[model samples]
Target chain A: MIDYRGLQALAMVIEHGGFERAARHLFITQSAVSQRVKHLEALIGQPVLMRTTPPKATAMGQRLHSHWQQVRLLEAGLGIASTPNQLTVRLTVNADSLATWLPEALVLPDHPNVSFDLLVEDQAVGLRRMRQGEVMACLCASAEPVNGGRVAFLGYLRYRAVASPEFIANYGLKDLSRLPDAPCLVFNRDDPLQHEFLATVVGGTPQRIHYCPSSEGFVEATRVGLGYGMIPELQFRDLLASGELVDVVPGYALSTPLYWHYWQTESDVMLNLRTQVIKIAKQRLLAEA
Target chain B: MIDYRGLQALAMVIEHGGFERAARHLFITQSAVSQRVKHLEALIGQPVLMRTTPPKATAMGQRLHSHWQQVRLLEAGLGIASTPNQLTVRLTVNADSLATWLPEALVLPDHPNVSFDLLVEDQAVGLRRMRQGEVMACLCASAEPVNGGRVAFLGYLRYRAVASPEFIANYGLKDLSRLPDAPCLVFNRDDPLQHEFLATVVGGTPQRIHYCPSSEGFVEATRVGLGYGMIPELQFRDLLASGELVDVVPGYALSTPLYWHYWQTESDVMLNLRTQVIKIAKQRLLAEA
Candidate 1:
């Protein structure tokens, strides 16, 4: 049988990236931490850590870590005498979602004991974190549920290709074909929304593309006429309404369907967090499937 | 001979993610974009792109795109009658470098035609972008030169494990072993410097860890006593001196050596940019390396 203490020590090492730090986190002596890890490795008959600088978990180690994390969450949900006050809800999310409706969802009642540890990445890649057990939940663009997780439709995040009035005028961009030569803003190389919209109107990449990774920074870059880009309808509503930004192609936009995936747990904290996210998303995002 | 125009068209399709957008970027009709890509594929006797909702580059296509990007940079550097006014310098950098000395390097004299497209990632992973031709230059932890790029030693970024005065007093964390129960802050999962230091002092990870991804946010969280964290010497010098924060293990710290890697090019812009970076890094960062 696996010793729970040894398992916990191993998980902490992977999470903290060093045995010494893991010992500090476990409130134990360095030798104790080392012995626990050695015991676990001896039990398994193989090495768990790479033992490189800032150690990495082997595949077996990753699986073990994932298992321990899930078990901990399950125990915490059952109120099984764990450190309840120190429960952390680790999750991955996209920047746009965090900027728009996520803050409201985070403040929802009934999750007083849960603190957040958010990992922000592009929605396209966010699910990988959940799959790898790096996060317990994820807000992603994928509609497919994780192996044992429940997926909920969270509506579409509408994006309009927009630019400042001065940018359009300065570049004389009357149609989409001119976009290739004009300065354009992109979230990152992985972000495909701008290209998806451009596919409908023109059909190519912009020669002069400005990459602004921050959600607010992207809007600011667009506002300052640094480049034209696809801006979220919810976040850029004020700027669009006040004539600070203009749609490059009127009535044309891309609507990315988003989904929330969470582990199927009996925990009230998980349920409450999921419900709050759905509620906020429905209220703020486009209702289209 | 390979058709340069068709290659350009194919590269745009990969960048923009579809033929329609590629056409728009190329200032051509959708049919023309389709024809160009088809012609290239027919000549190569294989499909280059996976025609999905958001098109993706095939292995062959990725190679072609990388080659095209490099060629474009070389052409631009030679001042070979391209869009001279729209020169964009793409690079990847670590957050601490971005927070500390990078901004000053960006404003160096004699580089008026250049604009920036910066990708913020961990220094350990930043070099991969340069290797993949995703960026022309990178600030990375690796001292080895990329295939044809020059590597310059940029000195060490020293970090001290620090916390707010109240937190140290409240937790009575005289040594590292007590860190497990106390709150601790991490930059992210990939950041192992804190754990590395802890391994020397305690030998385990903290159980109650908070991840703050932003450079400023991490410092703010540490200052507010949400948790203790490893902070860069250059960034937290003022706070350390002001008594708002205290070193958890005084006189003990980690110094990570950094390096700048860039494509070996005779292009005046590339040369000027490299020189300016080295100059600024030497001035602000530790000069020992």
Candidate 2:
């Protein structure tokens, strides 16, 4: 097996570019980086770094780096004390979720030992990071168990079809079947919620669909009469209350189930965070419906 | 912006426990851990760790750990290389896909810089992980775009209700409505593909649903006359070809559309992966039939 330190050194070399740069980043001499890389090459029996030009990792080097990340993540998950005073946990999150639930969920406030490096992606991608030992835990939608991890249900995110009152006035939709003729705002072509609803109730497809990629914008488009789209209840509640938005279908709503997935490895901080997230999810989001 | 290193150090401390243990794991001295922790505290103007018997991070420490995770992912997406050579791309995928598409997708002939960590989960919960930045990408069923990313339609995973000739003879499922009354194998309660098919085609529900979580077991259960199930086309292809497993509905198959979601970042590696994935998806998975 290759030494862990060598892998770290090679990783630094690749990241920092060239021996001198890596040496500077590590606060060591350029010769030290050269020696480490040479030693790593001897151990791996392969040239991990291309010594020419900008100094890049060979194909084998990239693979080693990937493995190194896995080792790091595993180490993190094991909760095997690395340093009593290191105060950081990498967090993966979705952007809209960051804007909404995360602020609400992470309300405990102030820690010197812990600092958050938030990576915002879609939920599915985040789960991948969790399993790879990248982030310790994640909020995902998968109910299927991840290897070395436990899965929990976080409850459904209720959504409803809403449009600006102006839209309603112009489109004059009295029944579901007429929705196909009206312009509609969608998150993208893949969003099937609106399509499912239409297929279930209207027996047709929306005639015109506008892709509004942002969550806030998707809702705003509907509010401004661009078209009808399903909006999450949490973000749209006040709008509905204020009558800025009205239900296209008063009694009908879409509820999507959310779940949390985390490494099953015993980590006190992860355990605590998961507990707190679930508690808030149940109290603030799930219970509201 | 806060120095991300501080957060990483803090996360390590929380994971490890005491300064001595953390120092050992980090290959540093106990004094170094104490110094870093102290420095972090001074920077944040808050005490993240409690000096108890074992030492523990405060609630604030926990929050920062989670926050730090997200930032690391964003940095990756931005191609802001960390620890140079070791670039780990994490993702959550389903077992079925792992068995089928994943190995083939990762058929890179020794490019060592890229290491893939596969987190296996069901389609239902994969989305949440994507949101958390745990992974850079995911294959999920949701059409809704995540907060910071775009949703791309990969293709549909088509499944059909199949059973052994003997099983069908025993159950006598001549009509769709008779399905609910007969013994049926299901992936889980969330395995609503069959239910949706029944509701859409027969306007009824299954009577006795047997839960068999494993993909292999689902097929076996149906073949051995345990129950009928909606089996994926890929899994049941050989059986169907051999006339062992017969499709209950020949022309009718249930198709679930899957989408690939990733952070909209300008990383060369991510872009390359996405491009390759799309190419394979088009060739292997049928888009429209």
Candidate 3:
């Protein structure tokens, strides 16, 4: 049988990126930490770490690390009474979700004794983190679940192609034909909502483009007429109502379906967290089948 | 024969991520932008864009986009007089390079009329962005050049395992063995310099770890004695001189070699940029083969 302490040492090395740091984390002698890893490697009769500039786990090492993480989560869930401060929940999410509804979801009542480590990325890309075993759960764009994960539909996020009033007047963009020469704002290279809207109405790419990656910055860029862009309803409702921003192309919008995915776990903490996220999302986002 | 205007439309659509946006970028009517792309598609007898939420280029579309970008760069180099404000250069780099030496390189005498869009990631990951056609150049860890890029060696960045005096007194980490149990700070998951130092001294993974992703935050965390960490020598020299931090493992350090990789181009602008970057890197980083 493998020593749990040795396994823990291996996990920490990967986590901390070195033995000495791992030792510091464990409050043990660096030599002791090394001995444990060495012992574990000898027991397994294989090298677990590929000692490069920053050590990386071998394939087997990666498998072992993933195993240890799952076991740690399980043990933590069961031993909640024994260690109240040990809960560290890692997750991945999209920037829009984070900017809009996720913060409220997190502070919901009955939140377990846990702190969160969030990895923010585009929703389409966020699911990859779960597949790589980097996070326990993810708020992703797809409905399909990764292996051993439960997927729940979270509603669609509606977006309007909006521009400031000054921008509309300056560009004189009364019809789709005039859109080509006007500068447009995009969240990033990978953001497609603007493209989808354009394809539906104008059927080509914009002639001039400005890329703004931040959610708030994207809105601000649009507000200042840097370029018109698709703004999430939740983020732009006030500006739209105040007439600070107007739909450049009235009667047209885009809706993106979102999903919550979590590693299938019997842990009550995990379930409660998932339920709260879904509940908050439903209240905040557009409900769609 | 393929119309160059149609090809430009396709490229803009892919770059800007939508048709109307592409039209705006081109300073043409959206219908004209659409007609150009449709004309190109008819000539090619294949749809180039995937029409996904954030439109993706089909394999053929990717090839065309790459070709168009190359042509645009060449034209810009030749027609420098026609458009003085059109030069926008995109590149990816590691944070340490940004925090230390890169900004100095940009303002070098006779610097071209260019604006930079920088994508910050780890050196190992940044190179992939170049490979994916996301950026024109990258400063990466590997010396191996990408398929069509010129690679020049930038010297090594030396790092030292450092701790505040207060932390040393509290943990009593005089010897390598005591490192395992002491909390250590990590820049991010991919940072392994601390691990490399630990493996050399005590030969194991750390038992306790704290991850601080931001470069500035990592330094601040270490200064506050949250944990010792491997800090870039350039970043910590003043702190060490002032006795705010001490080398935890004296006489031992980690050195990461960096390289500047840029697309092979006849453009004087490209060549000048490369020369400036190499010169600055040599002065700032540790000289090595």
Name the top DockQ candidate: 1
Q: Each model's number of backbone clashes?
A: 20, 76, 43
Better of 1 and 3 by TM-score: 1
Query: Could you give candidate 1's per-residue lDDT for residues A1-289 as a string of tens digits?
Result: 6777888888878766688878877889878988998899999988888888777888878777767776776676676666553556677888777656665576433433455677788765678778776677898889898788889999999899998898899778896578777776788878877767766788875666666676665776677666789988877888988999999989887888889898876367778778878997889888883
| TM-scores for every candidate against the unseen true structure | 0.65, 0.43, 0.57
Which residue runs does candidate 1 get wrong by more than 4 Å? A80-85, A107-115, A121-124, A128-134, A202-208, A237-244, B1-71, B81-89, B94-117, B127-135, B139-208, B212-289
Per-prediction DockQ comes to 0.15, 0.01, 0.06
By TM-score, the better pick of 2 and 3 is 3
Question: Per-residue lDDT of B1-289 in model 3, one digit per residue for the tens?
Answer: 5578888888778766688877877889888988888888888999888877556788778777766665666677675576543444567877677656665565423533454455677776777767776677888788898888778888998888998898888778986688876766665677777778788899876555555554544565577666788888887788899999898988878889998888876466667778888888888898963
lDDT of 1 by residue, B31-139 (tens): 9987887888899888878888677878777667766666665676665566453455777888777656676576523543465677887765777767776677898
Q: Per-model C-alpha lDDT, please? A: 0.76, 0.65, 0.74
RMSD vs true structure, all candidates: 7.3, 27.6, 10.4
Answer with 1 or 2, whichever has the higher DockQ: 1
Docking class of 2: incorrect
Off by over 4 Å in 3: A80-85, A108-113, A122-125, A131-134, A207-211, A241-244, B1-74, B77-88, B91-289
TM-score of chain A of each: 0.88, 0.74, 0.86
Error of 2 at B37 (Å): 6.6
Relative to the true structure, candidate 2 reaches a TM of: 0.43
Model 2 ranges with Cα > 4 A deviation: A1-289, B9-26, B29-85, B108-111, B122-124
